[model samples]
Target: MSAALMALTGHAEDRTAAAREWRAAAKPVVGYVGADVPVELLTAAGVLPLRLAGSPRADDGAGERYLGRGLDPAVRSILSRLLAGDYGQLDGLVVSRDCEASLRLFYAVRELRRIEPATALPPVQLVDVLHLPHHTTTRYVLAKVRQLRATLEGWVGHAIADADLTRAVVAHDRLRDLLTEVARLRRRQPARLTGTQALSVVAATTALPVERATELLQRLLAEAGSLPEAEGHRVFLTGSSHDSPDVYAALEAAGLLIVGEDHDWGDLLFHRRVGGSTELALAERYQHNGPSAARASIRRRAAHTAEAASACGARALLCYARRHDDGPPWDFPAQRAATGLPAVSLERQPYGALDIDARAVAARLRVTEEVAR
Candidate 1:
């Protein structure tokens, strides 16, 4: 692999490494727990915005105690890390009320900080942007974005100017364009990259500094055409957003190439850029950009899934939802009908190894392919 690809993959595998390095360098680092948080606002405030990922392998007994066993596994893992002081170095933390589990996480962290003053939790703020596509909802989301900017300003001890936001927006737009190119490469015939590699690159973008991430993406794209082609059944993944590439890696190892996905961690993350340099523009863009399982209607989600699958030349669809992450699974039936393709629904899945018969899935997909032919 090229050095750029290697660096991005490493950063994705170790999500906190880059943030720790930045913190050590005396730079302010703020962590966000959901996709809805405006990263541009954080960037404009001159702090590193790191997206937190749960470590599925972590022994999070504390998380079980605080969050209980019924919550989403990824959320529990994140709570465990917070309780363990894994993010003690962060200057601030933003938790979005994008989904129920993440909202619960915000409440738990806030209460924990209030009761246990000795806990090393960073100052936390909640960005609650409602996704209803009405003018009232848009106004509400815009107000929330402004509040987030104020909170970030307080953290950095300075007002975030429009110039700063404009510069940040421009930088992020460039990053988004570069990522779009990478996505195009993934959809190429005889795929230029593996699903795992594509996912790693996406995850790394949120973990690393924007400039560094953009540079790495540029380097990878320059060499992507020459990368060895990946061979497998072209598949589209939907349902729960993936924090790690483990699932993609396993599925690809089982003879499937996930060419596209409609999840926050994948294509939906960069589906739209900040339309303008202002907070209202950012709020409007996020609120209206793409269908999210947490906020969008089932029909819209299904339509997006079908459109994305067709665009990527996927022969089949895989809908995998994690335990307690209920929103995505509700769309599966609609998605199955809309796509009109062979589909598999792996619902209530765990965070780790997936614990499914991969070979059986591969065999079934092969049979479906033959039947389609």
Candidate 2:
């Protein structure tokens, strides 16, 4: 692997170091939980926006006492980190109602703030954006976007002018377009990029600033292009948002190439630009954002999966979900019917424990691939 690829895989270390330097320089930093929170808004407010991930090594004991055991491990881990002062440098945090866990997290953080004032997390704000496309919902979502933009501006103590927002939008759109190019490489036959590589790039982008992320990705694209294509059964993955590349690594080990996916952390995040004033464009983009199993109707979710699978020319589809995450399973039946293709459902996984059953999943994938052939 190239240095860029290595850096992409070891992004957590890179992010940690970069954040420390950013803080030493007194740069305002904002943390966000979901992909739905627009980076452009934060950029316009003159703050670095860091996407928070659940730590594989974090103990949920501190968090479980407040959120109970029903919350997703990822959520619990984030809460534990917050209580432990792991993200103490953040100027503020924006949590969205992207799923039940996210909504619960907003309340849980609020309660934590009420009870523990000293360890107070940076002011938390909820960015409520519904996926519904009705006019009423559209107006509501636009209003929310405007509200968030104002909130971020106030938090950063910067009056984000129109020019600042326009520049930020351009930067964000460039990042999205570059990622789209990388996705195309992943879709190539004898795939130019592995699932693990694709995922590493995605994870790294979420952590790094837009300009730096785009630069690294450009270098990565060049190196990946010259490499020989890989041979494997092309598979489409649908499941809860993956915070790590464990599942992708496991699938690749099983002789499957995850050419595409319909997850928040994947293709669903790559979308076209909205044309208009910065605020209006942000709202319009948010209103038409792609559907996720957690929030979209089952029919829409199934349609999205089938379309994504077909677009990538995948031989089979794999539905992988964690034990506590039930959203994917709820949408699987409809997706199976919609595709009418060879499909395999992996057993419920322990949160962040993809290695434990990787061999079993690979074996099942082989059977599914053979059936498809």
Candidate 3:
């Protein structure tokens, strides 16, 4: 692969670099708080979809002061960065509820707007999407989706034509298809790439324009295809949306290749595609896909994770929970019992270096190593 292609897959590793690249494109970027925001809709509306993952090196002091320290560290970091003008150039921001911290982030940002408009927060919108697949849920979320579309239309001062949405869906669906191929490689007996590398690709795509991301992914897939297969204790990671590759890097360093993860930031986000190329079809498909942590029962969540682990040939399961991220703990017991795999769970501070938790890493390494023995 050429140097540019290599950089495309690894470039989002640095938040500053990613932001600079996006800004250089000079598009009207719409920052999102979580993975649930529909990139298709944003793209159709001529806005670049940017997920607001705070810089890995950011301190949570400003975020804690505004939103309280009780929030997840990653969430706090997002708040800190937004308040400090890290994403000041965004044309708008959309916050949705895939988790509690995201919802809280939305509210905090709204309050911040009222308290001080000079910080250049851009326009912010809250997308209240219902997570379950019930009839009422679909209807409610679809309406919200339309409302969100209308909100964006007003901002852009033009109607998003059906053709535009169709094109957007096709583009996003193609991107998802390529990512699925990457996931297939990750699931191989000896993984085709490290979990950190796989995730870096995912993270990079989220920050780039759809066409650019797709082009980069195609090159990445080609590059990974030529590499020798990896060798390690194959593991399935669960819990927490990892914005940085540190956790995956740490796990891989411990002789575990993360073959799969049940986090939204990983397999969950890329596993599914929009069923149809229309707005209504896209809305329905997304709402009914499966319940995220905020919407599903422990049993449902556990079942999903266990099945994914089994499908990926993971010999063990590991979960790393950040402080105040409560959903994972609730699902752990059932997930462990259901999977019947060697398991390790650990606690870490938000955005803290995952590899630095010596005890947790040691315990996880021990489990994988023992299993291999």
Candidate 4:
């Protein structure tokens, strides 16, 4: 088998292992963090926390009927899969006001619990993102979080403790540092891993103990050799669910090197973590930094891409979303016109459907490289 396929299978295995690890170690694992939900909050609550978006893609079509807008085939399939007993094992789901699509997805699931009391699916509901000042799109998030927490606490029959939150903060902070080290390895040699492999970092981030993840990263880096020379084109992407190494992979595949980006799963989620703080403090810090609460995750995503274009030595900006994914549309036009850099946009479908032709994307990148050279 080709290295890519083998790696894909292995990556899936790693995810399974990580999820089982988290579930076995911590019950009622929650996967609701977007951009900056605090690990301490979940950890302190004795909940196994995972990022819901990281699950291997499935067909969720049943989710479409309940959503009001932007329901694409991919989204539908994923939701359908969910309703068909794919994620029935989840004890509860935490939804963030991530985007129109995500918000709708959350609503769809939330409604199910209300309408179908006997459904095997776990508790589901919306997460209000406290929108940033001047960005009223998600101002209800804070109240929503508190309410959600209370609901979660009541259901679990135990409230999340301040002390537990503090411990979670320490653990999360360590995880952040550990991920940073892994990012460093990518910066040095983009080929040592792929975007999916990098997802192992994210998977482990939500599941594995920070220390173990760190050791694995360190070991991975030890084997990382120099990046195989590229044709020297570079691009920064802005979109949904980007793992850092995945950013590098898209760039390289498009014949560019990834120097920077603003995707939450890429940078904002992994930006920087405060150290040695209490759980409440740590939760507060995450709430403060995460873009999930931003007025527009799209606009926020765009601005980050704009900034990266200048600083990351990028030759072009790529603003693409997975097919039917609307996360990039909100701020893309403005970003493309204003960044003073040429940009390319695409609609990608998980690891499966890449609506944008690879060669075409690569060709543009090559053109940029030729000019740069």
Candidate 5:
């Protein structure tokens, strides 16, 4: 492969090949459903949870035919490509009832393409997050996990014992340690990691097997650690799906590097697991992420956002709500007041068209950075 191709593939050039080995090492060959699903659970289950997403190169013709009029054309287009075979390689899929788009995506996956000739598309597991009340939702969630565990056991032809759970944690934690280093370097040094490159890190859980990802990550970490420190304005972002390295791309292009973030998909959610094989460790793993699929009272949503905002050290917070997303709406008011920091709210129609005006964000930060200097 060309050097350019190697870079795009990150640590492992042959993730598909690595995945086959991982599946052999693991049982059940599971795929997680939620963006917030703990990598530990799948690792422990001997499953590989690959995050599903849209990329510019993907074509969505067949996906459009699947969803019909259920979702908007843009969302359907993305789904068309994904279901049409974008992530057809995954053994099983985990679906979160997180938002309109995500929920719809889950539904479409379960309803359509329930079978494929090449491989079994992941069995869809619904995370019952109907947000009516805490107790009610929690019980539903716990039961769902049990069901998923049972399903996974059947797939593997054995059970996930305490030892298995603990072992998965060890392997996954090793991977997270590498990620944490990368995240810290991004903060302490600033911009060593980009938003796009960051997503590739998150994408690793599903895209490659544990052993190979760790090897690639080890190489990347050594290289990243040797890079020079980043000096400039540091901004914290709290939003959905900012893990794709666009932050690295955009901020680096403007001569600023993202030092920290409150985004749910990366550091915030990534830190939720460690050192436990107990059911509680597993349970807490799924519940504490920044956002959820359940419809909560407006108050709860704001609380979650305030958390991400305050915790992420955002000097300037960009609300990357995908045009009418409830997750961001719930967090807006509290997040606006959570920090003394200045904030920017950008409505995104999709990934390629982040309605955020680059000039506007840069102009605002430029003045602030100068003032700080």
Candidate 6:
């Protein structure tokens, strides 16, 4: 791997490294918890947008004490870290209503700050963008986006001009374009990069500065042709979002080459571009981009997953939903039927547990392929 790829992967693995560096330089950093938050607005507000990711290694006992065990493990992990002051450098935090877990996380954080005054929690904001495709939904989301802009402006103590937003939009659009090219490379006949590596590359973009992320991506793409091609049964992943590449690494190690995944941390992160520079355009783009497991209908989710898997030339599908994350499992049956491919569903998986019988999975995929042939 090139030095740039290594650096980006490092950032992905160490989620808070870039944010800490930025804070040490006396720059303000605003942390957001989910993919639904409009990062471009934060960039336009003259603050670094730090994407807050959860760790599988977090203390589940402590998390359960505060937020209870009913929440997704990823959300629990984030809450645990916040309680431990792991994200003290954040100037503010934005929680999106992208899923039920995240929305509940926002409420939990707010109540914790109230009851536990000594805890080092940042001021939090919520951006609720309803996902329904209707005029009222569009209007509501546009208002929410504008409201987020106002909140960010209040934090920076200055107006975020249209020019600032325009520049930010352009930069993000370029970054998305570069990521799309990287996706194409990953889908090549013999993938130039493994799914684990691709997840790291995409996750790093959320942690680093946009310009730096784009530069690193360009460097990686330039050096991609020289990387060793991955070999295994081509597979598509659809389930809970992956904050770390541990599962991908494990699956790839077991002879399953993950070419694509429809999770927020992977290809879905840049699925849509801000078609225009205006707030309304941004709202429309996100509200209608790809079908999200949490918000879109089962048919929509199934069609999107099928299209993405076919486009990537995947031979099989793997649906791995974490315990307590209900959305993905609800869509699994439809997704499997829509794809019309050999599929496996691993439900109620524990966080950080790589106990998947991946060898058996690989064998099954091979047998299915031979039978089809």
The residue-level lDDT of candidate 3 at 29 comes to 72
TM-score of each: 0.97, 0.94, 0.93, 0.76, 0.77, 0.97
Candidate 6: which pairs clash? Answer: none
Worst 10 residues of 3 by lDDT: 1-10
TM-score of decoy 4 = 0.76
Per-residue lDDT of model 3, residues 31-119, tens digit only: 88776787789999988787778666867798889888777888888888887777657778888877788898888888878888786
Estimate candidate 3's RMSD in Å: 2.4
Q: Provide the RMSD of all predictions against the true structure, rounded to 1 decimal.
A: 1.2, 1.9, 2.4, 4.8, 4.6, 1.3
Better of 1 and 3 by lDDT: 1
**Tens digits of lDDT, candidate 6, 222-323:** 998788888978999998889888788888888999999998889999999997999999899877866778888999999999999999999999888889
Query: What is the Cα-based lDDT of residue 128 in candidate 5?
Result: 47
Candidate 3 global TM-score: 0.93
Candidates in order have lDDT scores of: 0.88, 0.80, 0.78, 0.56, 0.56, 0.88
Error of 2 at 291 (Å): 0.9
Residues 250-368, candidate 1, lDDT per residue (tens digit)?
89998899999999899999988886887789999878866889889999999999999999999998888888889888999999899988887888888855768776777777787
> Candidate 5: TM-score?
0.77
Superior candidate under TM-score, 1 versus 3: 1
**lDDT tens digits by residue: candidate 5, 1-373:** 2232245356322334545665566534444444545556566666665555454335666666665654434456556655555444556666666556667777777765555534335556666444343665556666766776776676666788878777877787787777776676555534565554555565554566666667766776767645555555556665555434544466546654455555545665465545566655555555554444134444555565555445444456555555334465556556667554566666544553444556566676767545656
Query: What does candidate 5 score in Cα RMSD to the true structure?
Result: 4.6
lDDT of 2 at 178: 88
Candidate 4 or 1, higher lDDT: 1
